[model samples]
Target: MTTSSDQQHREAALTDTVLRSFESCTDPRLKLVLQSLVQHLHDFIRDVRLTEDEWRTAIDFLTEAGHITDDKRQEFILLSDVLGASMQTIAVNNEAFKDATESTVWGPFFVDGSPEIPLGGDMTLGAAGEPCWVEGSITDTDGNPVPDALVEVWEADENGRYDVQYRDGRTAARAHLRTGDDGGYRFWAVTPTPYPIPHDGPVGALLAAVGRSPMRAAHLHFLVRAAGYRELVTHIFVEGDELLADDAVFGVKASLVKQFERARGATPDGRELDGRSWSRVRFDIVLAPHGS
Candidate 1:
């Protein structure tokens, strides 16, 4: 025999019950955010009256996601990308200078302490798959060269696998190079090949249930940090990549696409012979002015 007043009080207790756990939070902003999140989540659950089976399915999916991750693969980040959450976060944080380089996905493959290497050195020393001479200049929007800018770059190997993915703990094909006097840097690596994201994880299961594919277009990832300029995290997308439109992470931007043209048969540019045909790519980075 539940009275009408008891039901009313119970309903009113919803907000109270949710806030009780957070009562010790001192930060007003954090408390506000947590409270709002609780309200929305509760409202959503009530609106849908989510079934126990559906909730169990979600838990199972997350569990599988955790099981698939080891040292190299980040199934959770892949999940965020496919669901557009990663892109949304990038968009929100990228509202600085309209004239500066656009920010792109940081991606999950970045490793700490890449081996320091000299300018114009080849990162692809062992196996030669494709010839690619990548040169880039970092500069301010007004066209002033940024010298000594630390340009950290990395990309998948010829087989579309990161060095860490196969090398375990040792430093593989990744390196960090500094810009020279001309504000230019160059490196030789394999021409990136499109590859599939790990499709055996929970994310892959979710995608399969909805009949989706897990693939990211071929691109080089860069993180540029200089003393006076805003730090930039972005990618240079190779033109004509098949996965541009259907990137699993939804990371493509019109501003980041660059052409990778086939180099002419043996010409002068101080480039030597590799059995594999070579490709040329030029990327110019526009950094934001210092303290803008």
Candidate 2:
């Protein structure tokens, strides 16, 4: 008869056999990573006393997540975000740049080849929302200006939907701009609004199972890059957003929050905005040097 002690011995033998199999791996990093992964996975399984039925269910859930992922949507990234894995990784990799701009998760909605606009140009493209003017400067950690930095910006409309969410997958409310010689850049965009992540897939089911809301805070996304400086991916969240404390992806940082004030006349540079009122925000970004 197979006793409990016999089962424990068998399990230990199986783990040792599996670990030995990785000893022949040629890549040192790969070998180390695989060994750690195996040990942790086995430990977790033992700690939970996971049953065969539960393992099968987990496999099914991952399979469904894979089936729903495609070019337009990334279920795996969504999985990482909802589980806080993405933010945790960012935190680990960005620990050295505490004084510089904090990084955040790059959501799945970013599209390549957005139209480039001039300084003080408008990115709204007649999108449906209140007009807002964003102005900022790019500088190094020591306060030296970085000229001609490429700034890519994208955000959802007032309705909390990206252009990709539409049936035709048309692009809107997104643009690429460059900092001027003085490291200053400005653009017009719609005010951001809180929105739910796409919740019709396996990730949604997981969130529901844990009784968590799927709403992200009101914010605008940015990707900035300059020569000799580290690439920065982050966002400026609107101050006092209702979901700021409970962002679905845990992306909010205190330094990234900025106030959006009401302005009823022309823009900051005195360019008449067709007599429409607008919101204004200034968010200066500082980048760390490469290898810092």
Candidate 3:
């Protein structure tokens, strides 16, 4: 009979062998990463005494995730998000720096080449949701305006569905715009609403099995970029969202929460709402210098 000590010795020997196999890797970083991965992976396997059935189930789960992924949907990213790995990775890369805006998970729904809109223009493009005015300023750590910054925004509609979720290939509730000379930006958009992340696939099944909800808090997404500053990928969560404390992807930060005040009749830009109610919110962003 193999004693527990013998079993541990055998596992360590196997891990060392795998580590040595990467000794010839040409890149120092690659070598370091592979060795550490081997060490941790082996340790986890040993700690769990993972059964063959469990290992096969994991492999099958990953296979299904890859099968569901495509240009319009990214199951792997969804998997990462649900596991809290996405937030953990973001936290590791975005260190604290003098009041710079916090970063969060970049959801799988983002698409490139979003339509561009002028300041104060409407980004809704006919999506179904309550109208909202989003205004904010882009500034550096020293409080100076960062003019001409590109701000990309996207969000789900009242029904909690993104444009990409529909079959017709229509774009709505998303656009990109540049900041004004004074670093101010304003645009019309749909007010954010609470929604569940796509939960019909492997990630959803995992959440269900673990008794966790796949719901995210109401929020607006932003990807702000400017020369000489670190890119800001974040969200402004609705202040009173009940899910704020339990965001599926763990993306909410206290500083990013903001109130969405109700509006009626007239808009700041003098547009007529024709008696329809609306909301307005402000989100001033501060960017850290590239090296900071």
RMSD of each: 3.5, 2.2, 1.3
Off by over 4 Å in 3: 1-3
| Candidate 2 residue-wise lDDT, 172-225, digit = tens | 899999999889999999989999999999999999999999999999999999
Model 3 local distance difference test score: 0.94
Ranking by TM-score: 3, 2, 1
Higher-TM-score candidate of 1 and 2 = 2
Best-performing candidate as measured by lDDT: 3
Residue 228, model 3: lDDT of 98
Candidate 3, residue 187: Cα displacement in angstroms equals: 0.4
Instruction: Score candidate 2 by TM-score against the native.
Output: 0.95
Query: Which pairs clash in the backbone of model 1?
Result: none
What TM-score does prediction 1 earn?
Answer: 0.88
Candidate 3: give the clashing pairs: none
Off by over 4 Å in 1: 1-16, 167-170, 267-269, 289-292
Worst 10 residues of 1 by lDDT: 267-276
Global lDDT of each model? 0.80, 0.90, 0.94
- lDDT string for model 1 (16-76, tens) is 7987889789998999899888888776755576689988998888888888877678878
Q: What is candidate 3's CA lDDT for residue 144?
A: 99
